[model samples]
Target chain A: MPNLYQEVIFWALFAITVFSALLVVGQRDMFRSALALIVTFLAIAGIFAQMNAEFLAVAQVLIYVGAVSVLVIFAVMFTKDMPHSTRSTNLQPVSIVVVGLLFIALSWAIFQSQWNEMPAELPVFVESTLVDSSSQLGTAIIRDYVMAFETVGVLLLAAVVGALALVRDK
Target chain B: MLERYLLLSVILFCIGLYGALSRRNIIAVLICTELMLNGVNVALVAFSRYSTPAFMRLTSVDASDSVKVLDGQAFAIFVVVVAAAEVALGLALVIALIRSRNTTDVTEINLMGN
Candidate 1:
């Protein structure tokens, strides 16, 4: 009962994810690689959308694609001579073979695992009811996971202060 | 369909890992790390959908009603926030290194004295 549009979107995202990943590794210019990483992030967001995690999809776009990618690009800009290097090369052949073997083993394990399907009793429109996901998440963080939430906040604050210190003139 | 998505995610992740481990340039390594993060995000959502009650019934597979989908989504959000923080810290370190060494190449930063 899968819809045609879902299939099309899935394939499109698959192509984009693979292509952008290739560009990320294959491109010589650091800036171009960053751009490809952005596209890869966006395509992953699309995949999140297809998985019905609407909130995550939007967050992925706003956070990773918008914020993190821009930060990396700016870092590239600040370190100007990085793009002039001619040393784009793959890892050693033995390592490549090891990685390939690891990938095959992992994929095989994934395929062999008997995954449980969705429960039948859950509501169909949970996405609609959960539209205020951020608020719900906030409540959970504050009530049950308050310590973890505060820790993350402090970590972000430390990161901002540290970044400023690093960039500031002595 | 799920298999295809999983395959793509795995490939992208491996490429990213290769780049992170092999590349000499810091920017290239960062880009690869981002790629690996995205791969994890994809897997999380995919598994979430797979475990959802509605999706299970759609595929006509009997699953326990106690399973919740929100956990995966919440974890993904946590990862995104952490990734943002990590990039901030990482870029700061990279900038500081560049300023001191006047270079960004990983191989050139051999100040540890072999």
Candidate 2:
């Protein structure tokens, strides 16, 4: 079981994540909403750290908070002059109902399911050096998941070329 | 503890859904989609920390006596990679839209209509 401090931190990060996500959705100013999105990503990274996924937490920071948020902010800046409002559309009522129903059904299923939970902490090794999760992840990617890894790289290259093609001068 | 995390994921997903469905700004819709993806990552990591598959439980073999599958974390990484690509293309598309339509309002840019 997680200690009291961990529990407190978890809840705090959770609250921050939810609040920032709401701001991202509700804020009228697009740039400020983008800023709030950075906060949400940061909080999610913190959550990942709490879950013992230190490698993923770092990746989340580097990729999401760093690259993705910057891209979004730039996009917002580029389109700053575009006439747009953040107000809800005519389907707002229907969307709210659908979202609410989705929440209820998902929560119910989560509660009803029986999960085979692992022990809270894995047994520590008696060896000289403790295994590093990041190193393990690197090995896993380059070894077992090499094919998928290369595919993602190719996909990223394709996306870059596609984006340039779409936006370049005609 | 796991349930709490899953609940948070559900809440985030729902909020994103509502925003994506109702908001007028195309950028906001993309941001909502990112929020939804983040929610999924939370659930994936939570499950990773909390559970191991039945096959890898007590019969694991290693120095640490743990099965280091890390499947959930791997999948989450892929999700992030795909999301980055998606956001890049999406932003590029947004830029293209702005260049052509001079607008970011999704409702106003109806190029295909009867």
Largest DockQ belongs to which candidate?
Answer: 2
lDDT of 2 by residue, B18-113 (tens): 899999999999999999998998898788667654445455556432324566777899999999999999999998988887888888877686
lDDT of each: 0.75, 0.84
- Candidate 2's residue-wise lDDT over A11-100, tens digit each? 999999999999998898989999999999999999988877788999999999999999999988888777676577899999989998
TM-score of 2: 0.93
lDDT of 1 by residue, B55-111 (tens): 334655433222244556666777777888878888888988887888888777788
State how far residue A151 of model 1 sits from its true place (Å): 1.9
Runs with alpha carbons beyond 4 Å of true place in candidate 1: A82-84, A88-91, A119-144, B52-67
Label model 1 with its docking quality class.
acceptable
Q: Which candidate is the best by TM-score?
A: 2
